[model samples]
Target: MNHEHKISNWDLIKNGLFGENTIFRMAISLCPAIAVTTSLKNGFLMGAAVLFVQTMVNITVSLLRNFINPRIRIPVFMLIISGWVSVTDMTMAAFAREAYRQMGLYIQLIVAFASILARAEMFANKNKVVPSMFDGIGMGLGFMFALVVISFFRELLGRGTIWGYEIVATKPLLIMLLPTGGFFAVGILMAFFNWIDIRFYGGKGAGGAGGH
Candidate 1:
């Protein structure tokens, strides 16, 4: 009776992985997806951090949904998410000191990313705990896919390497690793996705405009 709609776990995974890819589809978490993806390692690290934070927060929020007052849900969600991020920060500092140093403020900045909050408000708030967990994984994967691709390009042409493993022996573009390069990479990728959506997926699109 509870799962009357009968949404299977596999169905959920498919939804997140492809049907609702965070970048080319859902388009929910773009800020970090674009800003932090300077290298393959950075992109992967950021994505893993987001996955952990999102999954934990989603489950926690879903369990507390009934207790959380609607009037203060946003603030409550922010506090809970921040708690997980703090924990993650400390864990990273303990084991991966170098990554923790490299990540710096961005690691903590995950607290403010709208995507996590969006999950709490939209999916986790109403869904059961298990579904909420799946939602988080799906959304995080979508976000990761977007970030990895962008970082892949940025690290390659911008630096002539993939995640610091040198593929090209040249001096590289240099500019691709800069802030301006992030903008260029994201803009070009955005255009490419939009074109694909229009040409193939009908452009109904996800998220705000620009076809996500």
Candidate 2:
């Protein structure tokens, strides 16, 4: 049986949402997770941008897969990824200027995102266009989901605020806004999710994840 035929689109999406989330499970693309996730808004916007780029890249690559020569696939993939990232970069710059100013470079850096390129090479290149698109959506959503969770805690705990609205009138935990705090937050969350996987999902940490 063909893999694509056996797998439903929703299963493909669910796989990315929980089974093999890029940041939480695959552990790739931590730079943005740490660098841009100090605030919920930044994190969510970053995730949204990546989601769009990843989806477009996957669909484009899958559509062009047969035409791409095997020997030149890597460079071709980079070109595709970069093209989509540039589109995303320009769109964000035009619509969300302040956010673009804050994490603009990071958005450009999405051209080099492992999750996007990895999906292009691993799943998208081998799959049909619709399946590849869903895979991209799932993985992108997973990445966004991870960033949202990470940023939510970092902002709430560090700034005593959510989305720039002050909730607590006390001194915030300054460390949570720093890179050190990012690591701590990711570790604790990773461990918590790992516990959930082991206890109920019967997962073996990252090894049994759905990315592969």
Candidate 3:
């Protein structure tokens, strides 16, 4: 039905933040969502990096979509993704060296993120530059929101702190700091978000775990 044409820019943004959240809703890119979310600071940093790279990569891919050969689009996408990641890495290293040192690995890891590549293939490659940019912003912000929510709970419960400031004064759930705790936190929150979608928004529930 070509529903994409009917979707507005604001809806696109909302879709990323809620409809197809990279974590709770879409369930793609769980690795970083879980691994780096042990603390709010780390999660926020990773989210910010992904947001930048995702938006830039979408813009670049949209601009170059027609020029890219169909048979080699995957490779071209990889190149674009890596290129953006490298630029982000270098910029952060130069201007925010200390912070970059902590998040550099995660930023580089964005090169391999399925969500980014999926956007290039599924949305950016087929859309105009302006729409692509907005889509990227929506998706990036969605991912960032998910990370913040997950890390908020994880850090607060796991470490008794939020962004290093003591909140509870005692680790209410030490396991929340561990990998197992990450799974539990994500699962519980995923279900919570799903419930909200279904009950309030009449959403069908999260779609399959992929770029879409």
Q: TM per model?
A: 0.87, 0.96, 0.93
Q: Give the TM-score of candidate 3.
A: 0.93
lDDT of 2 at 72: 99
- The model with the greater TM-score, 1 or 2, is 2
Looking at candidate 1, what is the lDDT of residue 135?
A: 81
| Candidate 2 per-residue lDDT over residues 33-112, each given as its tens digit | 99999999999999999889889999999999999999999999999999999899999999999999999999999988
Regarding TM-score, does 1 or 3 come out ahead?
A: 3
The lDDT ranking, best first, is: 2, 3, 1
- Overall lDDT per candidate, in order of appearance: 0.80, 0.91, 0.88
Candidate 1 accuracy as lDDT: 0.80
Cα lDDT tens digits, model 1, 129-176, are 998898888877767777888899998988788878889998488888
Worst 10 residues of 3 by lDDT: 203-212
What are the C-alpha RMSDs, in order, of all predicted structures? 3.0, 1.5, 2.1
What is the Cα-based TM-score of model 1? Answer: 0.87
Error of 2 at 53 (Å): 0.6
Could you say which candidate leads in lDDT? 2
